[model samples]
Target: MRKYLIFIFIVLAVAGCKKKNKAVTSTIPGKPALTTPAQNSVCISGTIISATESQVLFTWNPAVNTDSYDLVLKNLLTYTSTTINTIDTKINATLLRNTPYEWYISAKQNSSSTTTQSDGWKFYNSGAGIVSYPPFPADIMYPAFGQVITPSNGKIELYWAGNSVGNNIASYTVCLGTTSNPPAIKNGLTESQLKDVAVTANTTYYWRIITFDADGNYTDSGLFQFKIQ
Candidate 1:
């Protein structure tokens, strides 16, 4: 009878341990749900100033067992990103005028190495008012920044995305040369792409685009460089 009682006690202890481990495993956090700015939202109004303005506020539903959150904002056109860590469910960020951005949130637990990412959403900042908003600079598309063309292609194609927000884009001017700040190779171009650009072998070429709006407002895309074989 004494041996039987000891065996029963050992079985109960092992069962209790297994039940506790299962409960802990079930408490692992899940992905957070993103809210606000709705997906593919456009023309969000905000102030454009030298000082940072709380242009847009991002929010998400808290994840279970999460201790903190990381919010990431990315400029779709410029390929720049910003991340903010917080314990709160919401955050405000400053964004550029007349630009598109994508954002998401990650829920994290303090004790675990796992992170849950919320669904991403995109929005466009319209900037202050209709009159205050200017057309954004062109975004380069082809031959990505700092790419090298080998085997002497002898020709390159330049492509970019032109912005037309409150105003219509009138024309584009392209500058391409060996210098960092190259002179205009073509001005008053009506197209978004320039093809068959002659290039010299074993030379780095710098290029940029200047976009003009019908309202006489203009914006410049910073310089980008590429090398030929």
Candidate 2:
């Protein structure tokens, strides 16, 4: 026969080219499964609804398949930190006053290799109750900034500030007066207490800081004139 039918047609064309090269090397091409895992990392939850004296409105909660998101704003009294706001899906670190801020957030995974750090936040900038930071002054925190320390000897160290205008520090009020519009006795004042009171020195104490919200509905940061030195 013609050389065994051309050697059986070249052995069935070399076994059909070795079964099409073993079906194209057993079909390979896989990679896609990493939905934030370094043990399910990345989390941040902080809120400061609204504030003024420039700006500082915050909100957070978004990260499920993240491919981008990183914001950092730290200046808790000038500890300095800013410049890192990459967002392809979530962002908010706009500030210009209303001090006291500390933030943190991170989550990026385009098939992650590594990059995850979230869970850090601190906030306090309660401005816009219409012009803040000027009513906690009966020498409020003027220990070395105004020279007026009195309310002496029972160990008086009272400082007030919370009519909330621009650097919102929303808590403070230590009263015990002699007329200057001071007579709030529900047992004699105690709301959002920040402790330090045992007055009776050079006595001439009259205080006020009723910026309220426990449903006692307040907003009175007038009257602060100390004397306990």
> Best lDDT goes to which candidate?
1
Give the per-residue lDDT of model 2 (tens digit) for 73-95: 66544557885655443444545
Q: Write the per-residue lDDT of candidate 1 for residues 1-229, one digit (tens) a residue.
A: 9999999999999999999998878445678888777665554544445543436778888889899999998886676899999999988777776666778988888888888888877666764444643456677887678998763257778899876555478999999999988999899899999888998898988998998988887877778898888
**Predictions in order: lDDT:** 0.79, 0.47
TM-scores for all candidates? 0.60, 0.21
Q: Return the TM-score for candidate 1, rounded to 2 decimals.
A: 0.60
Q: Which TM-score value belongs to model 2?
A: 0.21
Query: Considering every candidate listed, which one attains the maximal TM-score?
Result: 1
User: Which stretch of 10 consecutive residues in model 2 shows the poorest summed lDDT?
Assistant: 35-44
